[model samples]
Every structure is written in structure tokens, then in C-alpha cells.
Target: MHHSLSTGTPLRVQDMHKRFGQFAALDGVSLDVKGGELVCLLGPSGCGKTTLLRCIAGLERQDGGVIHIGSRDVSRLPPQARDYGILFQSYALFPNLTVEQNVAYGLTGASREEARRRVGEMLELVGLAGSEKKYPGQLSGGQQQRVAMARALAPSPSLLLLDEPMSALDARVREHLCGELRQLQKRLGITTLMVTHNQDEAMLMADRIAVMNHGKVEQYGTAQEIYSAPATPFVAEFVGQGNWLPFERGADGHARVGGLSLRLHGERAAIAHGRIFCRPEAIGVNPTVHEENLFRAQVREITFLGNRCRMSFELNELPGHALLAELAPERMPHLASPDIWVSLPPHSLQVFA
Candidate 1:
């Protein structure tokens, strides 16, 4: 991971396969990234997102798969020969080298003057100006990460790969660096692929997300699409948070939940012991039901979350699973407990067969 995924044929991988004895890490995995697009390979651990990234970086040789970067079949090329910039969770900067020297590590053959100019430009680009003389040991965690980033971009590789880009930073610095990294990537127009298990980070930084599990991609779509129309139960529950209620199939495009008929988009499979999904935002409080899609529920709890409220409920029919609802500050009063009637649009409900 090569037919090009990027626009105008920037990169391509065909039927990529990687295996360790009986364990197949990547099972014919394929992906495309349009030029200048930032795609995140999102998944839980052991899903092979990192394995695929390394395959493209030419760091790990795949048992089978064709890798191409800009029309060159570089499947056999070593990591350095592929001309891709990579950043890991660890900065991996040399402790003895100064910031400028570390960033210029890949530019040794260049004249010292040229190397200095490139390093300075990269430092300024990453907001680490005036720290050229400091070594990795002397900088803060965030500063060293920026220096590593500067080093990755100093040579201007066609593609950038970040492995758990924010795993090493503290929460405060992570928030600040997330925006800075996204802006810098956009400014340079570098095609990028990052792997992360954090759903919030994926939503904030990815143009599109590919959710993986068990060495397979369970779902791939825009962050909105995966969250709104999760293809399966795994994806619905994985990306961000969602509340699901058990429902049994009813007659003619309907499922019965808590003795209520829930209209479905279409008839579900016979094996479809289904569940209805309502995004926390889709759950409403004390709304007059002028039509269908109404159910009785009891509010279990409500927690204040500053700008937003997280409301929890136990449905009359699906008492085993708790439902989460989000509300604005003004609606906090309506989040009271003890038996409440709620309505959800039929379209807002998602069912997996």
C-alpha cells in the first residue's frame, strides 16, 4: 500500500498482503488518497493500520503487494529511497544533535549553506524558530515533537506519514499542536496519512477516515458519514459515541422496540436482530409527538459538560442498554428523570443487519 489513490496518480497499491506465519496482518488492503488530502487510517490496536503505513513507507516488506509512488513501483525500495517523510510517536531526534542539525540529517550531501537555509525554513514553518542550538534533550516534549516535524519536512517529501502523531504530548500541548500540524500540512500541500486510535483526533484532523478492525477496514468514509451512517454495529459504536437500543423486526419496514413500532428505512435481514441508533444530538427531551417515532424513556442521569450536556436514559423496551443524548445549556431543566416520552425521526435511526 499501488493503483494511485490520490488524484492524477500520486500513489497506488494493488492487492497488498502482509503475513507473519499463519497471521495475516494486512489482507489485500487497498486505499487511495487524493493529492493534498489528509487521510487518517483509524482503528483500534492490532488492526493493521500501522502495518499498512509501514508498507507504504517501505520500512516493512510485505509478503505480497505492489507499492507505487508517483508512477514508480518502489515495492523493493528501502525506507530512505522512497522519499517519504515520517514522524513517529517518539521524536527520534538524536540527543547529541542540535535542533538544526537534526532537521538537516537527511540533507548531508547538500552544501552547509543550503542545509542551514532549509532547516531555518522548516523551523519557522513549524513555529520553532530561535531554538536551533538546543538539543532534543533540552527541549520540552512539544518542542521536540515540532523539531521532529521540522526534520520530516525539511526535504519536502511528496508524502508525510505520522504514526500516533500526538501520543507523546500532554493534553494541553496536544490541543494546540493538533491545529498547528493540520495548518502546516495544508500550507505545504503534502499528501499525508496518519494512524490513530483516538476518534476525536481523527475527527478533528482527517479529511476522510478509514476505520479498521481485525486486520480489515470495517468502514471508510468522511467522519460525518461514518458517524451518521455507520455501515455496521462496530463502526456505529466505535467512531465517537452512540447509544443503541435493541429492536425486533416488525411487519413491512418496521422494528418493534419497547412495544412501539419503529419505521425502518427498509426491511432488514431475517438474521437482523436489529438495534436502532440515535446520535446523542438526535435524542430530544419532552417533545410533543404529532406523528410516529415516539417512545417512552426514563432519564437515568444528566451531567453538565460546560458548553454541552450529556443526558443518559433507560428506554422502557431497551432497559439493558443506556442511551446517551446531548443537549444545549438552556435545555438542562428538561433533563429530569422518571418516565419521559421522546420522539426521534425515523431517518435518524440506523439499523445493521
Candidate 2:
């Protein structure tokens, strides 16, 4: 079998728009995927992620804008002419056909020997070499998914589109397959676009993530970039766990949550009211060095999560407003008393106007 990697083609979607009746499914969505990179369209259901993937695959036509795959304008082309392979959520393997026949479904024009050789290569590539004689019904869900992947890659297309490909499997299986799929994609060097609502999967598999919301691309960047510095309130709330403390800008040009004044890292935006956003993990517990945002917090609840524990507490200075702090197992001993010192690092606080 030939293990040579194929060069990937870049994909660009320019100001794409689509709608159904009065509802806009894709509201001016646009993004770029570099060659050999895997970009994930991540969002909740009805967020236009799947629609955008369909538009790129030519299964759905856009009302405006252009779709380019490696310099070729494929916006108006048919699905067959797009030169891309797609894997659906259901695997879509023929139950009546054997694995070999299913993989060779796309190689209709090839001779008998060529089809056989290609089928063997694809099955081996997906780690199902000797299982080619089995039908789809005889395989496990993960095995069926691998068969679908083999069938999709048998054509050797430059672009691969995956639409929630691992959604059908169990949690453990899905996690394992996600790693396998990412490694295979990198090895093949194919420019790929995947639509997934699973944040863990997107963060684990994608080179970059496009977080979609309300039929629009909310933010697009690496996982760390989006998590650490979210561009919008929606992106911050949707991507990970966060603590939002509503604050009022005082007459002294400082922000305060209730009676306690807070210091932000960057220049304060000129706004009367905004929220102080911080991740649970960013809150420090009894730091060795003094911090600007340190305050005495009363422990309200503690949820132990094996490796780490989540402490829900309220600030002594600003009572009634509860905040959460995550602490490592080693730091749990410091919380011996109901009252403990916690610091919300100024740099960790994101002030949104």
C-alpha cells in the first residue's frame, strides 16, 4: 500500500448568505481554511454550522457570495463537481454490501483490479484491513464509522467535509475516535472542515475553531485564543465555564461589584455598567504573593471533582453575590476555615462594556 501523503487544497467562503423563508440560516458567514489544516465549525443546533458545510459541499446553494476550493470558484457547481468527500453523521454505509463494495462505491469508473486495490488500501488506511468481507450490520458503531471514513477517503479528494461524524457513538468511543481521526487527517494532509457542537471535540481536533451563533460566525481563532480572549459575550459564555459579576462604574472612575472596588488589567471602558468576567480556574486561592483583587471569601459549597474541587463562595466585602473558584487537590488543605482569601487576578478579569 502507498503511504504517500497528498497535498491539501485551501478553501475560502466569501460573505456567504442563505435563508429559508423569513429565517436566515447563514447570515453573511465567511471563513478561510488553509491547506492541510482542519478547521471546525462549532456551535449549537440551528447555529448554521451544518448549513455552511452543506453550502461548501454544494448540497445547498447560497443566495449570495462565492465558495472557492483552491482558486476554483465552486459556488455554482454541483456536489459531484466539487471534488470533495463528505462523511455524514449516520455513516451512510450500504447494509446489503460488503465493506469492500461499500468503499469502492465511488470508484465506479475504475477497472476491477484498480477498484480492488483501492478498496484494500482504504480499509488498511482506516485500520480495518481484514474486515473488508463483513457487512455494515456486522460491525460496531465505531467500526461502521471507520468504514464510512474509508469510503470517503477512497476517492482521495483534496477537501474532506465531516458533519458530526462521531455523534452516534458513546462518550468513551467518541473521545478515542476523535484522536484517531485527527491523527489520520494530519497524516493525509487534507484540508478539512468539520461541523460539531462538541466543544471538547473541536478543541481537541481542530487547528482553528469557528464559533457560530445566531447564523453568524461569532469568533474564529485557535482554541486558546478564543478561550483566553473572547471577542464577544456570547463567545465567552458559550465556549467554556465562566463567572460573571455585574458591576457598576463609580463616579471615581473605578468599577465596583456592590461596595467592593475592583481593578482591571486594561484601561477601563467608559461605560456606567458592565460585567466582570473571569474563568473559575483563573481565581487564585491564598496566593503566596499579594494580588490587587484579593478579598476574603466565605465558603458556601464545595464540589469535589477528583483531581480538582470547585468551591462556591461569597465575598465578605460584597455579600449576597456568589462566585466560584476551582482549586487543585494540593490546595484543598488551605480551605480549612469557612473564611479564606481568594484573588481574582486583574489580568484574568475581562471587562466588557
Candidate 3:
């Protein structure tokens, strides 16, 4: 990586909007990415995450909004005119060209000797040091991906745009390369924006997550914040595995969860109607010690998932409603019976309106 590229500049997208005929792809989207920060645009399909990335990369022209890299406005510029590096999910490497050539292709502006040096450095940076002479077909999936990364970074751009870069790889390989990618991004100090629908991937690699829905940014915060304090009902259900139970506002300005009345958190507590969402792990299963928010339920289903067991229970008070709880394997010994009591911590139940 070049010395100048190591010090990333800030990125700002203000009130971005894009449309394809009758359908809106991006609607009033705005985001801020600090220097050397990694932000993931996470959402389900048709949520406009990739569209936002393309707008930022200048691959797609937005109908309205301003995009700034540091202090420059390059929204109108074409993709090649902008000073940024991009990595596609396909690992778009040339089959005919050797790894060395693919990496050096971006270094057209540098002297021959300088380009060679940069190519070697980039390959080494991505852990593909001496395999430069081999073609993309000769390398493994992970290695080919690395070569694509090397090619992108060889030019030393300030911003790195990744469009589902790891979605094509196998689970194990994707996990391993995700770790490497995070480390390399930190080491090089590049401002990165990645688009991934995978929740785990976003949680593992991003400093902050931008959850989008229907071409709008639903919430923007750290992974913990997005997961624990979702701003909208869509965010609560989309970001992680959770249960959204029917909820109604109490006359006392609290929330009624089945038979229990608990105080809601944040601004949603004031809303009239919504669902109270809670994660399976947040619901305690037959606690060893007594705790608040305890509720009685009967087990409806059980699933063994490695170190933890996922058990579904139907709330005794709320007919036709079920809650999922994940407990350790040791806790399942006594929980084998259908009769079980679970506790929902007040803090874990987020009222989404």
C-alpha cells in the first residue's frame, strides 16, 4: 500500500435518490464514513444496498444527492474518473493474463520498475507473494479472490468499494478470507464500504452497519446498536434472528407482552402499535436463579445446534404466539419436558414501531 493511501479521507453521501422507471432504488439515502472506517450496507434483496454502493462508486448515476470524498464532489464523475478501488463478487480476474499482469494492470501510470515493485508488494500484501506467474484458473477460489484484491489495491486508492466480495466462496473459505480482509483493511487504513446481505459477515467486518429497506436507510449504527436497539420493525426482524410478538401500548405508557406489563425503551415506547422483538439468546431457559420478567410456557419444538439448543415455546397466556429461546446443552437436561419457564429481560425486548 502507498503511504498516501494508508491515511484515508472521509466519505459523505447526502440525500441520495435513484429510480428505475416506476420503482425507486434509492430514496433519500444519507451516510457518513470517517477516515479509515469500515461501514457495511446490509439489507435483504431489493433493499438498494448494491445500488447505494454503485452510486458511491459512480457506476450508477443518482437522480438527486451529493457524494463527497473528503472535500471533493465526484458524484457526476464516471467510475474510472474517481480515485477509488472496487472488488466485485465475481473476482473479475483475466483468465489469459497471469496474476502479475492482472495486479500490474492498474499501475499504468507508474513507471515499469515502480509498477513491478507495487505488484510484488500488493501480491505479498494479500498473501499471494510468489504465485504471480500463474493464471487465475490455476489458483484456488480463495487465492483468485486474493489476486482480485491485490489488483484493486495495487493502485492504492483512498476508498475501497466491495460488492458482496465473499458471497461466492464456500463457507469455510469465506470465513477465513473475511478475517484476512478485515486485517488487511486495518493494516492499510483504507476507508471501505462493503455491501452484504449476510448478517454475520456485516457483524464481523464492519465498524458500523447501515441497515436499508425499500431504498431507504432504516438505521445506521454499530452492529451491537443495530442488533440491540433497532430503530424500526424492519430493522429488528432483518438484522438478526429474533421473534416479534404482538404488542400494544398500555394505558400507563408501558408495553403489554402477553400477560406481563413491562416498560419499553427508546422512542418507540410512545408509539401506539408495534411488535416487541427479542432474540432467542436473550430469553433465559429455566434459570438456575430467580430473575425478573419470568414467564411460563410449554415447549413446542427443540433443535440441536452444536453447542447450543434452540427450543420453541408457546406462551401460556398468549395463545397462538410462540417464543424461541436458545440455551446451552447442559441446560437441556431438565428442559427436555414440555413444561418450561422462560424469562425475558426487559432490556432485551425492543419495542419496534
Best by lDDT: 2
Task: Report the poorest 10 consecutive residues by lDDT, candidate 2.
Answer: 1-10
Please report, as a residue range, the 10-residue window in candidate 1 with the lowest summed lDDT: 1-10
Listed in order, each prediction's TM-score against the native is 0.92, 0.96, 0.94
Pairs of residues clashing in candidate 3: none
Backbone N/Cα/C clashes per model: 8, 0, 0
Q: Which stretches of candidate 1 lie over 4 Å from their true place?
A: 1-9, 266-272, 288-291, 318-320
- Model 2 lDDT vs. the true structure? 0.90
| Global local distance difference test of model 1 | 0.82
Deviating ranges (above 4 Å) for candidate 3: 1-6, 251-254, 257-271
On lDDT, the stronger of 1 and 2 is: 2
lDDT of 3 at 105: 88
In the predicted model 1, the residue pairs found to clash are 2-12, 2-13, 2-14, 3-12, 4-11, 5-32, 6-33, 6-34
Candidate order (TM-score) = 2, 3, 1
- Tell me the tens digit of each residue's lDDT in model 1 across 1-353: 12133332256667788997888889988777777778899988988999999999988899988988777888999898897899999889999999988999988589999999999888998888989998899899998999999999888788899999898888889988998998887767778889999898999998889898877788878999998889888898888778776778777777777667777764342335667777888866777546457778888878899999887887686666687888898977665557787777677778765
lDDT of 3 by residue, 17-55 (tens): 999999999999999999899999999999999999999
Q: Which regions in candidate 2 have their CA more than 4 angstroms from the true location?
A: 1-6, 251-253, 269-272
